[model samples]
Target chain A: MELELESEGGELVVPVELLYGITEELTVTVVLPFRDPFENGRLGSVGLRAKWRFATRFSPGRADAVAAVGGITVPRSSADGPQAGPVIIAGLAAGRESRRWYYFAGVRTAIHLADEGNDPGEQLLLNVAWGVRPWLTEYLAPDLVLLVEASSRTEGRTRVNGQTVDASGGEVLSVAPAFLLSYRNVMLKGGVQIPVWEHLNDAGRSEDVRILAALELHW
Target chain B: MNRTLFVLLAGFAFGVTPAAAQDAQRDSTEQVAPAAHPDIVMRVDGLACPFCAHGLERKLDALEATETVEIRLNEGLVLLYLRDEHSVSDQALTKAVTDAGFVVRAIERHPPTEGTD
Candidate 1:
């Protein structure tokens, strides 16, 4: 089990996750999120995700792998109100990693089910990342890595009681520079995401700079 | 206050004391000692990050025969020291590595040096 706290645009989300390895190539994770603890603290949706590494190529000190990812988020009521419905998520990820450098790309989609005459729409997310290790160190020593990621998000139109919400859907592209530091079983990761481009259907609040920091421990 | 905390954490993450450095050296020497050579050495692929590699260590440690596990990140090598009179099979080692989200590229077995048993 690992606990992670993520903050975006001044909102805090704490997610507790448990991972289970079912086979040599497959793993599953369960995540429960708690949002807005500093204000109207409440529980968010519970999610389950599965990843299967279907293809792999290995060399002496490098490897490349492609994984199929699928997941579902169960809607739950929060301090504000109940969510529209459950969300089904699916995606594919491919990455290559060596002793000094790493690269990754992934695409994911989430389809939100309608409930009580409300449809929350679908979302598509794409991400690409590059990483570098400044110094190569053995185990038990502190290690640091630097990474930069680019992402794009697009959403479909949302409906309420058969009416399309004009400002409900749009697209945003962002870039983030991050760092990962680790020693033994503990890790610290943090980043700031800055929106570079955006297009909305109607007038709405544009996305601002977002910050995140997380600490993880494996036992 | 938050900035100060971040600076402190960063310092801790990048700093290593002399004692810790010596311990790390000793640990590596123990694995390669003539009298105490590791029983198994595995070359693992896709081990890019130190933080993510902990899973591989945990999986290997779960084996009944495993006494100590040391990793060489640059070479993608994992050295296993086993308990007395205990043994781990190649299949088991491969499975452990795979379960930790890595592929085992090669495995080598080394017998204890003479008169060291």
Candidate 2:
């Protein structure tokens, strides 16, 4: 079980995820998110995702792996939010984990399909992260890890009734510093993303700093 | 005649006591056998966090022969103590670790030596 909360641009989003491991290398997840844009808060799109770790290498206390993730988000009614059609998502990620250090890089793309006359912006996201463990500890002991992540997001323009929405999309780059604390099977993590650069279209709202936190449990 | 019978009964009682005591001692020793050194030790990779390592613990514990498990995260080592008279194969152990999303770097077996008890 995973419960995540994020505050961005005066909007609050809460996403709950349930994940199941089918095999050591395969996992499935269901995401249900609730978003509040300062008025008429409601449930957002529902998403289903599958992750497959296809390749791995190991040496001593270190390991590296590559994985692919694919998912689909089913849109809710127009009253839910701006999303009016289903979205397809695909991504590839590779990472390495060692006793004292970790690193990961990934890219994801979301294609929003048109529904009726409303077309939402398609998005591309790129991310990189590095982490370190402050102190080495044995299992069942409290452990803490610090990480820094950088991400860039770009979105294509949206069109409604065959007319392009001038302020619909643009690009932003952000960096986040986060921490993860774990004990046995439970983990808590949080981060704040600070936008460093932005290029929005005319009348587009500039990106703001976002705060995120999550709790995860495994049994 | 009574005196002779009493002496014979006393001799029999004395003989049975030591044998029963020996049996009890053997039983106690057998009970402590499982507490000896772990039968198998595995060096697992990617055990960087306690939360992620918990899945590996659960997977290894599910093996049929496993009785108990101990993990040393800093060293990426997992110790398995098996049930008496039970053994798990290397293939099974490797699969268990792999399924838990980790790699088995190396495995060492220290099966009990015969007559060491």
Candidate 3:
């Protein structure tokens, strides 16, 4: 959900998640996605994330210290195609919750290496969840959330149609307003990406609209 | 006419008076069982947000360790009371927490019922 949908000139990648959550604050995320460039229908990656609690940790007496996270991403490489090695992310984050509102903010950077070269990307994401009505609480409540994301690239090489490409126009920023419906453990979430402003090679040509659905199972 | 009047009066009287109320028996406290245990109290390091905690809570419940799941944000701990002892091992519990992008700082065993026992 943190990944951007659009860039200045290229297509943004999307992943459909499964085995989404295998542990606490940790989720086993495997995604398979294929677009015009990948050609191969079965090209994707598997990754993991560790998120800390924002709501409960903020009360008078709660265990809400910020969180530390680390994970690896392995891509599915194919014959006669470039392979995207694993991507690693390490970062810190914190959050808080009110009667009907939840807020989260964090910063992180990814270390990715491919046959073309090694590229690192840094991003900061902020999320807000609001409960709109009691009627919305009936299994699925229609709610709204506001998101703000900012990213910059200091160094890295990118691939275009499986070839080494330029990492020009390195900085991009976006703000999005989203809506979600939560029914018990099942959450249905969707949103649109709007570019506030950014500097990039093809900066304004491509815009992204992303839809995400996730189910959280706990014991 | 006298017979009709008598019948109407009897029906009105019966409707006016409330039927004998069931005995107002007090509920016995013993009937309400106390919170059960052999419970697990797991403190996680990365549970820094609500959605993450909520998602883990759902996953754990799906696995059935859910008679009583207490998510205490203040202590950064999740206390689970199982219906039976065979719920899950400490390792499995730790794994569940860790996979959610969290670290299991500690896992403790708690007494079934509250008290000095």
Best by DockQ: 1
lDDT of candidate 2 over B1-117, digit per residue (tens): 435533543443332334334434544654565576888889887777777887888798789888778888877799988888888888889888988888888888885432211
Lowest lDDT sum, 10 consecutive residues, model 1 chain B, at: B11-20
- Number of backbone collisions per candidate, in order? 0, 1, 40
Chain A of model 1 scored by TM-score = 0.93
For candidate 1, the chain B TM-score comes to 0.67
Error of 3 at A161 (Å): 16
**For all the candidates, what are their Cα RMSDs to the real structure?**
4.7, 17.0, 16.7
Candidate 2 regions with alpha-carbon error over 4 angstroms: A36-41, B1-36, B112-117
Candidate 3 deviant stretches above 4 angstroms: A1-40, A50-65, A79-84, A114-169, A202-219, B1-117
TM-score per candidate: 0.83, 0.83, 0.49
Poorest 10 consecutive residues by lDDT, candidate 3 chain A? A133-142
TM-score of chain B for predicted candidate 2: 0.65
> How much is A89 displaced in model 3, in angstroms?
1.5
A111-165: candidate 3 lDDT, tens digit per residue: 7654345333333333333323222121112233344433333333465446555
In model 3, the Cα lDDT at residue A42 comes to: 44
Q: Which ten residues in a row have the lowest lDDT in candidate 2 chain B?
A: B11-20
